[model samples]
Target: MFKEIIFKEDAINKPEKGRLPTSIAVLCGVTILALCTLLVGALISTQRHSEGLQQVVSSMLNKSGVENPVTAVLLNFRSYDTLLEIAVLLIVAIVMLPQATVSKSLSLIRVQQSADPGLIMSSLLRFLAPTLIIMGGYMLWTGAYSPGGAFQAGALIAGAGILIFTNVQYQVNMQSFAFRALLSIGLCIFILSGFAVALQTGQFLEYPQKYASAIILFIETAATVSIATTLLLLYLAVAGTQEEFNHDA
Candidate 1:
């Protein structure tokens, strides 16, 4: 106990490697200044380049096959970037998949304990889940014509799924083939669509203009489901490991 106290005293006496508050403040100020400078420069450069592209994109919008400019760019003009984005998300979901095996890792008793939702919470979740699901579906359908898209739709559905999963007594079975399939279906759809289009057009994801709208809709629909499932898995993985929640305060 004496040695521990002395060690703590020594630690308290140490001045964080001689980094004074003023020095630390200056370091942070410099970093902020540098970041602001870079950001300003990028904004200026982008503005200079983007001025001409507005009319160009507007002229080509009819050919891009989507009423929404953002969707056109993401799903049609530069789809490979979105493909890579989905692939990265899939990798993260796969890594977190094991933690979502609540049926295997958490005992039935603890699982029940962790799902200790009160009457109010259960009622709220019941209301929110259906509302969110409806909103997600609307958003997914509107992406081709409006600001809403797959990511936003997926996020909304994930929120619903999280509420339902955390507040309810149902345990997620990660071992189920359907669960894994849902987690990976987005990337698989993207890849298969890319290859199918490539076989016809000699370039991956280069959808023929006539079929672009349908193709984007199909891809976005599958991605929406996968995105929701993957995000739900992510939350489950973290929530399952927190044993303290099973105990009362």
Candidate 2:
């Protein structure tokens, strides 16, 4: 019953009236029109005023004290937009982690014995998970002063999660709200910290010179946590599971 719903065969009964050449021509026409529209929009948008805006941005960034100009703009002058961007990221995480529908046909399949992974995979994953997680931490911590940041760290940490999911018995699912909340907390903390900074100083996200490094550190830590959790959740959403948990065994 649920199989019919979950695995619907749409193409089997669907009408197929178009010839290959006609379909190809229609697709090419749409692509060409889209490219032309984009070209025209770009040409019209970048005028004299746009150049003035660019100069203003360059001047402001030039005066900023941050080592990374992009970070300075994102976390300082345009902080309000950054807040909304964080919110959007949280929303995307939430949307991606919804409960999956169970298929009845899948339930009918019997479990068969496969080659045992035994102690080797378990030991390897146990060793690798911590190592990768530590690497991620290091990457996040040095982002402000060095080459890595939250995204890079998160990706590294997610590699560990994938290893665990594939080689170990545990499985994380998109429908799990606890996991989603863990992912969202980092972004929430960041936004709240920014707001707190605003309260302390009249300007939004204006960190005092005395605590500049500390504030950036805190924000980066939060970003690292959130990014790692979100990426882990993304991996789980893509990697489905059917194994039952056996706590007593």
Candidate 3:
């Protein structure tokens, strides 16, 4: 009986080893074919005389109430898309949060001695955190006329949050009310702005040209805060899960 069981297990494992290579080869071939098809399609499409959105964009910038074309497109021309994107990020952060029954004690604990940062890292973080915050604010401000925007700003701020949380002594409460509020504030502002515009123009998100820049700026500011908070919470949630697993082990 022991020999039969061992033979059956070996047979099962042997087939998997053979099938694994075959499956990998098939997947590789399919991926290569798909990529080639996409490249060819791109080449053919670009060769055609296609009157793209350039003309429309040129006209849009004049009435967009912003000097930056990219900003105008993101916050004005296609703002509904940006709103939806923010909602998606909020949903992801909400999903990542620990369950209500999870013990508060298990949510955060001291970093393992092996993973603790040395003096140099701690000193660097002190300088980098403030610099990142200032840079993020600058990015948000310059989004109106240059390359930076809320997304870039949010990422920088999130990086700073990550540095703070990774230090041995720091902890963030992912489930706190203030954190939740900050995470949702952007979405709230976005929805309210849409309704306000609807009240005036009978169309959702259609900002008046006179107030377009101001409205966009307000939305961007809220979005920056919400995005940063949401991302930081996500990191904390992931780190908490890992810590829980390690404790269990």
- Candidate 3 C-alpha lDDT tens digits along 13-74: 54222234667879988999999999999998876666678779878797997889899999
Alpha carbon lDDT of residue 220, candidate 3?
A: 96
Write down the RMSD of all candidates, one decimal each: 6.6, 7.9, 7.1
> Please, what are the lDDT tens digits per residue for candidate 1 over residues 166-194?
76555556656677788889999999999
Worst 10 residues of 3 by lDDT: 1-10
What TM-score does structure 1 among the candidates reach? 0.77
Clashes of 1: 0
User: Rank order by lDDT, top first?
Assistant: 3, 1, 2
TM values, all candidates:
0.77, 0.65, 0.78
Candidate 3: pairs in clash: none
lDDT of 3 at 36: 100
| Model 1 spans > 4 angstroms off | 1-21, 34-52, 99-116, 241-249
Report the lDDT tens digits of candidate 2 across residue range 1-249. Answer: 012332345545544454357777799889999999999999899664546455665676534445555555666567577667767777777787645553322322222234345788879987999999999988877665557766688789878877876664554533444555667776777777877777877776776655666676677677667777777767656664533321211
C-alpha local distance difference test of each model:
0.82, 0.65, 0.82
